[model samples]
Target: MSTVKDVSKDSLHSTEKVADTDSSGTSSIHGAEAAVFEKRVWWKLDLSVLGVITMFYLLSWLDRTNLGNARVAGLQKDLKLTNDQYSIALTVTFVPYIIAELPSNLLLKVVGPDRLLPTLLTLWGIVTTLQGVIHNYAGLLACRFFLGLLEGGVLPGLVLYLSLFYPREHLQKRVSAVFASSSLAGAFSGLLAAGIMEMSGKGGRPGWAWIFILEGLFTVIFGVFTFFVLPSSPSRCSLLSEKEKEYVIQRLREDGAISKDDRADAFSWGEVLRAFQLPQVWFSLFIFFFHGTILYSLSYFAPSIIQGLGYTANQAQLMSVPPYAAAFVCTLVLSYIADKYHCRGAVVMFCGTCCVVGFAMFLSSHNHAVQYGSLFLTLSGINTGAPTITTWTANNTAPHVRRASAIAVVCMFTNIGGILSTWLLGSLSAPPRYTKATAVLLAFAVGLTLFAAINTAYLYYQNKKKAEIRATITKEDEPAGLGDRSAWFEYIL
Candidate 1:
């Protein structure tokens, strides 16, 4: 095994040779030594990078989804809110949320993730904590809006950050880990809410209030810790030695990773416009839109759904836990299989099929046992498919700013589904049998299945075209620069 020092020296010596642009502008590697070095350092990178981002996402989801838990803990009753008003509170968040994602991602490119992500986390934590103190519908709406505004950048920002470190083939599992953290947070939020509800009158605060306060505090603490813990990029990560860092960067180069020059360039409106031109970006937006409908509906309404099954409020909270826990496990497994086989499209379509079946079962069955069992499939399927779609978009896009814009645009459109979900599921008139809402969600699930199939077929066609081009083009005839347009850059299906 080559030592870190040995790898670093070899990498430095090879830089000139690697930088040479033969029409493709991609580096060729001296194989086995590079492979050995990568294997040696990847585990450390995964632990430090993926671990911290996953934690941040966990806390973000915990704070965001706790509103559902709070609603069950008597938030609506105390605020004297009708179901429509409560729905408005949820819907208002996405106003700022959608407007902020694109600009925030652009800002992230300027300030860097280490600084930007923690700052967003801390601000959202403050907003989340303030939700505990809101007395009226107006106050609650204000807090929710700010919470969404502050949180808008997190998912897209983290996706872009991960893209900087991992190759296209390796991204699905890391993205899944971050998403599984969200599922784990959903499960944990239920248990935590159940416990916090026990503090209903403690310190002159209601149980729902306590849930926000405690979870927000936890987020703030973790956000502060992340600022010190997360390195901005591979080259800046202090946890690794110089040689390890060299190996990481070298491997990325060999794999045709986006260059630092592309990442560090000044933000351009041209890149943003180019992102919109890509068909994959539009397909991703539609895919995630339906995905958001299912995901946010569950995150915000699962407890209510469980309560509708005639469980007690507390029992409903506990029942919510199992679906999310199942989702956490299934998401990890599904993502692992997708990455291992390099079959993102197939895995996504499979997960979408599960969602469709789950929703169909929910609509057709009146038996509580059958409905409850369906919750597991619904949560697991949507959770698994959401990250897969996100990773798919991120993987196919190129250059840092364009990727950022593409993700932000997809997230922006997708979250409109969030707003729709709140209105659809939070209807005051639709009580125990929200039959209408379930039917709508079922339609969304069917839409997801259709979108996944279409997107997969499109990607297959593009890959076939790229393969043909690669066969005809000489090295000197290949498209240059770091973008995905290179003749050799095939889309991952």
Candidate 2:
């Protein structure tokens, strides 16, 4: 709820110097009041866009994970799938995800997400509905692959879209809200799937098939409506006044790594090369890949895993609800703490530790009650860890094309891990003792903690060096190449 003016005024009064230029072009404070006013205006506009974006993210997730629900309703049996066929279906989705990210993000920039995103949502929804009619693995594979291809760029493209709308400091909490909606989807999937499972007598098709038909239809309908409701950017939004649009643009420039008009030209390969040069991009990819593996394995398979524990099919579907509810609560709580403290890396480390402990609990017991309890911990940790890492990575990038390129690159790597995870957690594998899967996930957790720690340490080192460089040069003598940018551009870690 805090305004940009609130932060700017506070910064002005604080000991840290506010950037300014005197007649000789040396650092000094000049007209702080006008600066604060411009900033406050921008903050309000950004928040409105963020609110709409949150709804888009929530629907995007519901569309993606409904397949998990279908799996529970006899999707496998009806298609006459072999044991490995389900894995093929999952792996096929990632192929499009890995291939389409960069191109789709570029397309969003030109066509505008307002037009492109809804088009994608509707197309994928139709594909999802068609999934219910697949008579064999080949049919299911085609649907799943196209579904992945269609939905592939939405997540990263939206992030790039949002970067054009808000300052870096204000970004994390909003990104967290969008990411947390995934947890909400997990909860909603269980509740909706439970009802659909019980509707077996309503239609000749299995209850699981109806789940896809209805959910996909709903998404397609919403997509048609959202195309009209969503805005292209702050400058085009009717929700803000002309004055407010200028303010939002100014505030983002002040806090962002790049200037507001940096992307005014057509898309260029230079931005892509620049993003690829940053070490953080590679680190982000590795971290996302591991977290993606953990998240998808649990998200897609938890109900089946629960069913394996000697519960009836309906009971298994019903039981998926509570852990996801807990996951949703944990996600919001953890995101709030991260934003409040502005401590991204530490939170990820904590989540990594939680994953380790949770998996250990799963490994130690096969009791239905104990395993159920452990699932809450596992789902919460893995889901929370993924968002925290992604939100952190997003905050580190510059504005415009570089941000889009970095996001596409990160998503490209992470989804490959999704393919790995689907195969790693096998449908044919016996229940209650998926020791191999658990062990693989556990190794990932430890790797995550180690990698996050390394990134954090590297950030600390970079900050120290920047401070040293600032200390060595006075305002008048500062090098002109890097311009007047402050040493305050800290990495999210």
Candidate 3:
């Protein structure tokens, strides 16, 4: 169990590995430590962890967003719900979600991912399954709200978990890759839901019930698999070679601190307050709120939107697959670039710009093809930029008390956007098109673009200052010093 300070020291060690050595009274500087071998080791660990986290997240999303499919398959009719009542169901979930977010994230740091995440994922899956059995709107509301409570930790937990395994520079791509699974879930949900809905008359269950039952069951099964398979951190990963573990530790040390231990003293109210005070936290939260507003509103209503274009329910669900697929491709490509360039801010800005164009097109277009293309654009923006922002913000924080607190606070604020989106695109906004929802999404896209720009500028300013400080301090003083010298190296807007 290395202290965060030890981890910090390791990072400094990584930067100095290519030190000057005296040979025959001549100075010779060593080259970087085997970049190819180190990178191969990194990639191996990345693939293993990425595979486990991606599948875990895919189930997480399918359980939550599949409700959109259920809605179209007679859930509202069975509950005798008005549009407002459905929005209320969505809104109620966010209440517990917001309340639980920070607590849950802090708990993840306390208990560690090995025990906490899989347990919560399994519990939420069971809760999701209960929605199928609910006979009334009250019951559905209860299930959804509890589901949110169980799920509140998932995104932030994963963000915090990945921080333990990767460097800040490497994190953006990994995050983007993992988040692309959500787009895959959207596509898969559509495909799977279409099949399940087709089984409407079988087993004496409604199509909506079948959607919940099948998806929920799959989630539980996957959760159990994650428990056995997911690595707690690079230090404990069975698949990594000893050299790889050293490499991982060194790379992480080179970047910033992340914990491998269960940080028991991780929950501090003062640190939590400080997290909230940071402009980076608030900026990302605000952007995520609007980002979620656009993302969930479109994801939940996408099939319905296509159905509004005169297609049947099944046809609409089928049509939903393409945009998600396109988003997946674009997100992965952008993630690779972001990681390669070590420029998360620039990548996110470009993605946000794309979202603006997509949302604007959706708002104004009458042609179905153009509208469908806009779906791709909007998703590319939210899906591509979201993971970058999340990974970027998370990696910028220190480990333990502050990191857990900040992740939770940011996530809590972000989920509020989900609640707001539900209300913004009430069922009443459908049919000829939810003009109100589209317009709001466009406005938010512009806001997010500007926010991303400001965030980029702040990061660049801080980076510039760090460079100046490094230039002032010679390499010899670097190892024993720099504690207060780069103290204001913050990610803020």
Candidate 4:
């Protein structure tokens, strides 16, 4: 078996002294060798792991948000549904959606993401296709509910899955890759919806029906493809040899020094209980919820909002493409900056500011050009939160089980934000400026600013305490089930 390199006696002595007060984990491997090996492993994972996850996320986003395109293309009129009922359908999906995430994440501990995530997409894709043929509002609601039930856990599951492979410092961009793909998917959803909607009446169905049918089937094809390809863990990746895999796993374990608890890696209710006891998880939930309101509002309503700007449905579909494209680019750029600088909270605050500015502009404007421009700013703000927040929380939470559970807990509340957004934007707001909707979303943008700052300050204080604790406590005195509470554990600010 491959092993970590040994430190020189003098070097080991120095590190031991430093470790008594330092919060960062110490590595036995030589720095140069560690860097080279880590670089190679990461390069391979970027190609194999990150790309596949991004593709899955794109497909997921397409399946979830295409309803916006469909709505623009006459789903509401076709189903003979009133606005409140349509909003209820949106809300209904999130109910099961929110309810499913925690258990789904906990279940991820049992099944592994490679096995569980694809099953979710494949099943949801089938449900999505069935939506194309639905005769009435009730069928739409049922399909939506099941879609929620299936799709709810995919994000948190994917987040937890990623936390397994990456060290905390290197996690944001990889996680961003998953969330950023949604923007690309939004763009694709518009372009694809534009093309697919043309198939309307060709098979005795509306263009909107074709949108659902084609996107859903495509999702199924990709989900099945992913099922065969995605590796369960970094050690399982085919790109690395057995030695490299062991080295990779060992280094990751070292990086997560909060794993003082023997039971931490094991799947157990005790770990779940430990996750519930974390204060940071609760703080993260508030930010996730605030961000989710903007996220869901923007993704699910942009096409309709554009159409309401006096553009035709087709025009709205095409117009919806640019802001999301910009958001995708912005998400990547900011993710890089955040990861490079360890500035996740700062980046999140910046994105939230973008939303505030964007919404302020949108609310002030009657001009379609100005409103459209505002979308670029607003959506750039909206789509970037998932990566930053997930990484931030994952960075602080440790051991396999609690991190997984923390991710699920915060993500559950995030979707709950989506439920509220549907009502705020969908039920109460309407065409020609959506004043109430924009205002509420603007308020959420401001809230993101407040909470991101507070959380950052709180984590900074906690990190200081962890450092002090490390100074006072020797390894032999450390207790089990410590997880993130481990004295050696440091929160990323």
The C-alpha TM-scores of every prediction are 0.92, 0.89, 0.88, 0.93
How high is the CA lDDT of each candidate model? 0.83, 0.75, 0.75, 0.83
1 against 4, candidate with superior TM-score: 4
Clashing residue pairs in candidate 2 are 42-247, 42-248
For 247-318, candidate 4 gives per-residue lDDT tens digits of: 556556766722524455878778788887877777788899999989999899998888888889898999
- Residue pairs with backbone atoms closer than 3 Å in model 1 (clashes): none
Candidate ordering by lDDT (highest first): 4, 1, 3, 2
Output the lDDT of residue 152, model 4.
Answer: 89
RMSD (Å) per prediction: 5.2, 5.0, 5.0, 4.9
Error of 3 at 292 (Å): 1.5
Q: Any idea what lDDT model 2 has?
A: 0.75
Candidate 4, after superposition: displacement of residue 324 in Å? 0.8
Residue 177 CA displacement from its true place in model 2, Å:
1.0
TM-score-based ranking, best first? Answer: 4, 1, 2, 3
State the displacement of the C-alpha of residue 271, model 2, in Å, after optimal TM-score superposition. Answer: 2.0
Pitting candidate 3 against candidate 4, the one with the higher TM-score is: 4
Off by over 4 Å in 4: 6-34, 257-262
